[model samples]
Target: MTPASLTDLKAPAKLNLFLHVTGRRADGYHLLQSVFVPIDWCDTLHLHLRTDGQITRHDLTATLPPEDLCLKAARLLQQHSGTSLGADVHIDKQVPWGAGLGGGSSDAATVLKGLNTLWGLHWPTERLAELAVQLGADVPFFIHGRPAWVEGVGEQITPIELPQALFDTPVAVLKPPVAIPTPAIFGSENLRRDEKPAIVADFLAAPKQFGCNNLEEPAKAYSQEVVQALEWMQARFGNSRMTGSGSAVFAWVDTLSHQRQPFTPADVGVSDLTQTGPWVGRMCRLIRQA
Candidate 1:
């Protein structure tokens, strides 16, 4: 029997372990190479099936724009599948937006997944992913639900098993109060667009220390906060890099040294950072699946 409601669905955020712009297409889309992994931090969603054929969204924690991705995703699935069913989506937004964390994309993917079951469509992941890519470059990643090597304007995804050492490693993700517009960074004249393509074996050789985010230089140019966040993370963790486009930086925390203690935000003064402004920080770990 098809359930009328699917509650407490999780939409996990992703980190671009390293992002590189390899080239540009004649259409103006940039070719990319990156390793993407799901993180423990996520947004919670509750979906209720609506027989009246009306899709709606209610934000519980943070206010979302009227036409957020969740609404678009649900509507797309409805139109593509020609389903009479609609959904009432409730989002408990936790992951900060414009942080390069793929929060909106994850939420959209989760809505598609939830509605697939609620409406009894039972579409395969591949079929759903085809629709997902139409929604956003990052949406398909969440639909596929695994760590992947992404390329070709984010449409190409090849799932890979990460080393056990990195599977659950502690990571600190910090976001400044301001959001960096993705277009600003991508359109900047300073952006680098000719990085050498990297292979899976190359990344697997040193998963944690491999490669750099080609988007970082342009991002730093757009937002001084990005520079500050990167420097702040570097000061504490000794290594820091921007994820995806900009304004959010992350570093792998050294857990081996403090094996006796459980990881927390206080360990990295995240609370103090938050008090200083609207800075958002969390101690996260890599999740095997979304």
Candidate 2:
């Protein structure tokens, strides 16, 4: 007997510890390599089963686009599974959009996972992930619910364990009001497309100070806010990097110096930064698993 409702399903956000662009495909898709880890900041979802075969979504927090990924995911699963059961999905969005935080993809993945159980599909994670990739590159990562080494335009996912120093580390993620369009960043002539390919061993050797985000250079050109956010983080943490592509940048709260005292949001001047502009800041921990 499957439950009619599943409430409080969480859709977590992810950070690209490191994102590299190795090459471009014939179809103009850029090849990428990155270590993606889930964070504690998340969106909450509530799902209720329906017998009338009508899928609906209600936004509880932030307003989503009319045809957001969550609705698409539910329709995709319902169609693929040939299930007459439908769902009324209510999303309590917390993760900020256009921050390159994978919020939409995470919500879509959660919808698929939650509906799979509610509808009694009993499909394996692999099956769910297969559908995930069709929706977006980042959706599969959330479906797997683990820290992963992602490559090849975000389809290839190899789960990896993080070192203790990186795991559960406090991070300050700051996002400006502007949303940098991903296509604009990718289409920019200045975007780097030929970074040398890296391996898991290379990242493992220095997870904290790994390879840089190839997309950041192009992203900065599109938005001065992006530049400001990066500068703000770097000033406080001594190092800051953009995650994925756009408007959000993050830094580990504590520095690498073993003798240095640990820092928190107050020590890093989060309040001052927020006061200066329409910046959203969160003190989050890097989770080992989603």
Candidate 3:
């Protein structure tokens, strides 16, 4: 017999206002300070409760693990509260993985949040946030789903309200055919690690406080195919930037009248996502598609 019922959930993507690596710990944890802003685009996660004490997952889209952070999040919550109920997880993914959009982290955070409700754990957001950090550095920000000033390896967070108009501007998400691994980019000795840190209060006060991703340059160099994708997006829209590491770049377009959901349209001639060279991406307005 199941102890509880099922519920639905949404996991959104995030953009970093700016990422700064202040220092590195002896244990190899890179301390950081960045402002996280949740855009309307997201991945959908559905959860069903179970009585048999089993936790399983089904990905409706591509197969991914991102080091199994989603599963780890559920296990962490269960261990922390000692909840007996289990969850059958279904991920209806739209957020592109390794796109510097915080998709995986958001998915993990959702599990933490969803299970808390499904199992009747009754943990507050603050408590759930602490548990999220154990799963990943970016998990806490998604729990709040607000623009935030992040510090201390992204564990420390101060939420802020961004102008809703950012979404009004249509943004195009362009993913190159390749994947840029986060670990590899961060591990490179040439990657900049000397930037100073900032306080949360001041950063939120001015959202565009600093420049874009510090990892963008090196990341593109590592993935030449991503450079092509960036070029395509820029050709169609105005200004563009590479999010997070690399392999995915985005641009701002004013109108997305044709798209039911906000999206950057595909390359007219390109259909295959793995062609690796020049593929047309889609055009969508800035809204949470998943």
Model number with the top lDDT: 1
Model 2, span 1-290: residue lDDT tens: 99999999989999999999999999989899999999999999999999999999976444457788999999999999999999999988888899999999999999999999999999999999999999999999999988999999999999998898876468888878778789998999879888999988989999989899999999998887788778878887778999988788998877545125444434445556555556677878888767
Per-residue CA lDDT of candidate 1, range 1-290, in tens?
A: 99989999999999999998999999999999999999999999999989999998876444467888989999999999999989899988899889999999999999999999999999999999999989989999999889999999999999998999886578888888778889998899989999999999999999999999988998888877788788778877888999988677999887567434554445555566565557777878899988
TM-score for each of the candidates: 0.94, 0.93, 0.83
Candidate 2 segments whose C-alpha is farther than 4 A from its true place = 60-63, 255-277
Candidate 2: pairs in clash: none
Give me candidate 1's TM-score against the actual structure.
0.94
Q: What lDDT score goes with residue 43 in model 1?
A: 93
Show where candidate 1 strays beyond 4 Å: 60-63, 255-276
Report lDDT (Cα) of residue 109, candidate 3: 88
Residue 7 accuracy (lDDT) in model 1:
92
What order do candidates take by lDDT, descending?
Answer: 1, 2, 3
Of 2 and 3, which scores higher on TM-score? Answer: 2
lDDT of each candidate versus the true structure: 0.88, 0.88, 0.70
